[model samples]
Target: MNRVLRAALFALVVAYLIAPLLVVAGVSLNERQVLFFPPQGLSLRWYGAAFTDPSWYRPAINSLLVATFAALIAVSIALPLSYVVWRYRVRYAKAVMAMGLAPFALPPVITALGALALWIVLQSYGRPYTVVLSHGAFLTTLPLATLTVGLQNLNPQLVEAARTMGATGSAVFRTIVFPFVRPYLIAGFVFAFVLSLNEYIIAYMTVGFTFETLPVKIFASLRYGYSPVMAAISVLFFAFAVVVFAAVGRLGDLPRLLGADETD
Candidate 1:
């Protein structure tokens, strides 16, 4: 395609992705109580309402808590697991890796159902920590994959050099390996955090309608008719995600982390 045509196509794709979010943000600023396009007037009433409302605040807090814990847990698990896979290349490496990633590859509903069933069998009910554990189970795979890719691109000779300098295994890892892979680690953590924050089905199935996350709150709000508060929530979520990912991109070659060709 010609440069002009390619540019136009890119712009079109951008518009298609951004349109709904822009509309939601615009409606959030509308002075009217109900959501409407081309808002009657601009105001921050809905934003204020969202913050002030316990109903919204509660769910937002729950989502934040879950996402934070999930990110930490996923990174912790993925780090060692990925290190083993990359360094050892064990006989069952492929099988182990596939099992780790199976949850993400399977249909979400099926995974949720399976998780729910497991939770029931294990008698873990109404436990927020268990919910975090369940979310982390699937989320860890993304970070593992991301870190593995980063490791693949690294020079193994560096680790050997550190060892030759009398560095112990832990010392070499901490001093040499960690710095090079830190960017990928951050990228993976953010990926897991964002995915967990936006995820609904597994969370809904595991926690049920009794507990609410941001997405679940939004879904519930739909039953009571569209409100400007929902739009405000949507805007907040979108802005937060964009700012986070943009920060990550600024710190690292984000396209490479996403498995995109750096030359392109």
Candidate 2:
């Protein structure tokens, strides 16, 4: 009875989370040109429209570019930074990390305004590359934390064993430390990529229509009016997100990175 009750509760929670996606997907396939779940009659017109429209495809490409580049830069920086902090236990590392996490602690609107102000002062407004860097700055905190957790989880004796074998610092990290933290390194990259992909406020304020992205386009579309095409785009967004997450989990223990004790 307890197992059944637990399972029932889990199902309810999952359903609550997934219900909106299901509705969007259902409406995307609706034969009628309006949003409806269970969707009148099924059709594929909107899916075709999602692919062929320039407005849809352009922003899709831009988002892909931004998310890819932002994740790469953020993770590359975080891996080394995380290692340095963990290895040296530097006097000011905690203060530095606290500052890195400040953007996340504040409301996103505040961060968006900050990014806008930064771009303006630097004369980089409306540039996609600047937006990418801005996102990297904003989202670095998570990957840093993930790397820290990964490093902390490593058995200290392993490092000592490598050192006793006359291994140099780089060699010790390359052979001993990296393998243990590999999962979290990958996990951090995945988290950074997904968050950057879905994020809107910074992109909206910093770049706007100049280098429009999928989220920005979605906001524009919804601002104008909702349609079956928007539903189709939403469904595609759901699909891409699912793919990113599934592929990443194949490379690492996602739940563990997310604070789960169990590796599985």
Candidate 3:
């Protein structure tokens, strides 16, 4: 009876989470000009329209570019920091990591507000890179987590063994530490990229009209009207996320990187 109840609950939760996306995807195929839930009839016209529209295409391209850069930046910063935290037990490392994670932990409005203020102070408000860095900083939490988990799972005896053989810290890392943590680094990068791809508040607040990302564009379109093209854009974003997860799943034990206990 308990097992049956658990399966039922799981099904309920999954349905709750997935029903909205399925609705949007269904609506994207609507044949009528109006956005409707039942989707008057099935058609692929909006998918073509979404791809052909410059407003949609331009923002999506910008989002992809910025997210790619943000992921790179986040992983580069998080890998070393997480390694030092895990390997050396560096003083105040937790505090420092906490600071780095603050942007993600705080309300999005607060982080967006802060990034906006910093850009204003530096007079760099209009640059696309501002959004990249903001997303990078905000996403540091992901790589930091996965890398820390990866480092924790590494054998300390391996480090000792390498040191006993005269391996320098840098040598030990490159040869021993990096090989183990590389998958987590990549997982973190994928996480950062996907998060940045979907982000809007900081992107909108920092660059305003100077740069636009897909989320911002969709939001603007909603301000005036709604269309099946927006649904198509959403479905495309959903498909991209699915592909990213499929790739990440192939790259590593996705559950372990997410802090699941491998011992289990």
Worst 10 contiguous positions by lDDT, candidate 1: 122-131
Residue-pair clashes per prediction, in order, are 0, 0, 0
Tell me model 3's lDDT, rounded to 2 decimals: 0.89
* Residue pair clashes in candidate 2: none
Worst 10 residues of 2 by lDDT: 255-264
For candidate 1, give the lDDT of residue 54.
93
Give me candidate 1's TM-score against the actual structure: 0.94
lDDT of each: 0.86, 0.85, 0.89
RMSD of 3: 1.4
Q: Write the per-residue lDDT of candidate 2 for residues 1-264, one digit (tens) a residue.
A: 699999999999999989998888888888977788889898999889878988888898898899889988888778878787788878887677777668778999999999999989999999889889988988888788888888877888889888998999999988889888888887887788888888899999999999998899989988888878988888777787788788877766777777666554
- Candidate 2 residue spans exceeding 4 A from truth: 1-5, 262-264
The most accurate candidate by lDDT is 3
Over the stretch 1-264, how does candidate 3's per-residue lDDT look in tens digits? Answer: 699999999999999989999999989999987888888989999999887889888998999999999999888889878877787767898888897777767889999999999999999997999999988888988888888889889999999999999999999999999998899888888889999999989999998668989899889889988889999989998898999899888867888888898856
Q: What is the per-residue lDDT of model 1 for residues 151-222, given as tens digits with 9 covering 90 to 100? A: 888789988887888999889779877887898898989999999999988888788666788888888888
Candidate 3: the clashing residue pairs are none
- For residue 174, model 3's alpha carbon misses the true position, in angstroms, by 1.1
Which regions in candidate 3 have their CA more than 4 angstroms from the true location? none
